[model samples]
Target chain A: MKITVSEKNGKEINVWFPTWLILNRFGARITWQVLKKHEVHITSRQLRRLVRAMKKCKKTHPGWRLVEVSEHDGGRVVIDI
Target chain B: METIGKRISRLRREAGYTQDTLADVLGITPQAISKWECDITCPDISLLPALAKALGVTTDELLSGKSESEPAVKIVPKDERRDIGDMMLKIVVDSNDGDKVRVNIPMALVQVALEMGMELPQVSNKDCLRGIDLGEIVNLVKAGAVGNLVEVESSDGDVVRIFVE
Candidate 1:
């Protein structure tokens, strides 16, 4: 995963991390529980499927821009997965 | 529930789906489908949306044998949440005086510090981090909470954000 944070002052920070940080069993299971809090149902098996799908996408789609957002105060954030 | 099973079975056949086809669409085993049709088990509430769509029915009909406008996918089983060690917590503070503070510490260290009642110099000494309970943050993270865990704004216009990625 890659993250970029831009402050209102125009300072930009970039951070890149391995996908395994979130795709690992512990991270995936925790994510399943978190989504449950939002009433989004997902089984452990289903979450595993999601992880697998993400891994496949990672291989097939390099440098995929997953999200981008800019705040009213001029701060911007972007994510690539 | 038996009627629901019959409804699913009937609708599945009506939609030209063998058990295997429907199972494939929803990413489940055919035996689970058979069990559902036999009332031996119920589909996870989370699966209802995809299941209903596969069978050309609304979730309402799937659950109660009555048709409604559309399907709603909601509710899933609650289960255990566990995490691994050596994860890092990132904290970013934008001070009003234009100073930016970025700190990263391993979650394993936070857990140990909390257990030992030891204060961490990395964050404890920062003014923006004062008065916030690191222990509670750890507990929330342990409970499967992630993303931006904390955001604080001081009267002087400093902003602090903590993220667990």
Candidate 2:
């Protein structure tokens, strides 16, 4: 599944396969160990700051819909990234 | 019990004796000398005199734990007034889909953007368009998603203004 960010200026930033960007932004090393658990990919431009900001904002407001993403396991997810 | 690790380490160097050399003079293993400095073990009472002589210090100085002192840390007054310039920019992007995204760039991030060749405005909270579009705007907002911006007007004389280019 993919997550899309709609900007205030009538534009959309589409984010596909957010796992890589998520883990990378959270400073989780994208190794074979993580890949075996879940799959993720992203665009050429890295989303390090984007994911970090999302996580930081989420800490204050748990319901801010800045970037929406899909989860695989449907388990209890704490969105640190 | 009062052996100072740093003091021992410093005295060892001043003596110009390698661990093995000191150990040889003291009739002990080099590993034992290492442990003494590392504080893993202490020297025997009888060995204090020889150790002090070799280390160029009196037994009182070594065992008493007095050595080179450190500078006292000066705590700055918490109330020192810092005037962050009053410049603030509020970018509220409302997409055709009805999602309104607002980003309040902090002074630090604004300075960072300026350093990266982005144009920033002078005066407090003046809005400057650096050719930032919707997609880029979203990305920038997403990058700064963690911070909440409080719009401060330029009237407040003591303030820091961040220019976004």
Candidate 3:
């Protein structure tokens, strides 16, 4: 997953995350856990704000899609696109 | 606004500890405790966790004067689409008074798994679902109709809801 951060005029800021990561459950959960482990606390309220921002940007920016594979029982991997 | 000193004083008193006793527990001088209670000096930031633990409250409660017992509704942003691949998904909505309603995905998402060549469990709750077409549900979801599937409220003011958005 790629996150882009840019600062404008030392005040305005912009943040973006991979749309596929936001749309996928396994990807989003893994990202949340990794951020928490690194002491970067992103609460649900903050996540909602991020999602709303992403939705607004999706209308303008070209979106990217990804296929995620999750491990299941019996040594199986389920692929979701 | 209550000063940190007043909050410390109130919590210390509520915990039934004299200034000297509290200082003894924290390994600080009684004068320092007196200063903290009088708003003359504040506890170091490093001591907040220990201070909160000593006062039998969370660090948030110690700082914000709001106990966790208060009803603070939190909006959780959830992505429910991944439950589709799991096949054995069950959604439950419940109230504080032990009222609940459950919805089980018997075959809707399971059909997606089937199409993807994943093995389905032999014994499943497939019979529980009413006459619903899995293909139609999948088509609707692909067409972006995957939100707020069902919602119902009981006469006892308990709400049970399921959403796949």
**Which prediction has the highest lDDT against the true structure?**
1
Instruction: List each candidate's DockQ score.
Output: 0.03, 0.04, 0.02
Using DockQ, give the best candidate's number: 2
Per-residue alpha-carbon lDDT of candidate 2 for residues B90-150, written as tens digits (9 for 90 to 100): 4443333333334444333344344333442321213433233323433443343212222
Q: State the lDDT at A34 in candidate 2.
A: 48
DockQ of 1: 0.03
Q: Candidate 2 - CAPRI tier?
A: incorrect
Candidate 1 collision pairs: none
Per-residue lDDT value at B88 in model 1:
57
lDDT by residue for model 3 (B1-165), tens: 698889999999999999989898888899998899899998988888988999999989988987887533222234534433322233445554553334344333335333433221221222222233445545545444444443445565555443443
**Candidate numbers, best lDDT first, in rank order:** 1, 3, 2
User: lDDT tens string, model 1, A18-78?
Assistant: 8899888998889878866745565677677666656665665566555555565778787
Model 2's chain A TM-score stands at 0.26
Which residue ranges in model 1 land beyond 4 Å of their true spot? A1-81, B1-82, B119-124
lDDT of 2 by residue, A29-62 (tens): 4432343243333321323443443344445433
Q: Which is the winner by lDDT between candidate 1 and candidate 3?
A: 1
lDDT of 2 at A25: 35
The candidate, 1 or 2, that scores higher on DockQ is: 2
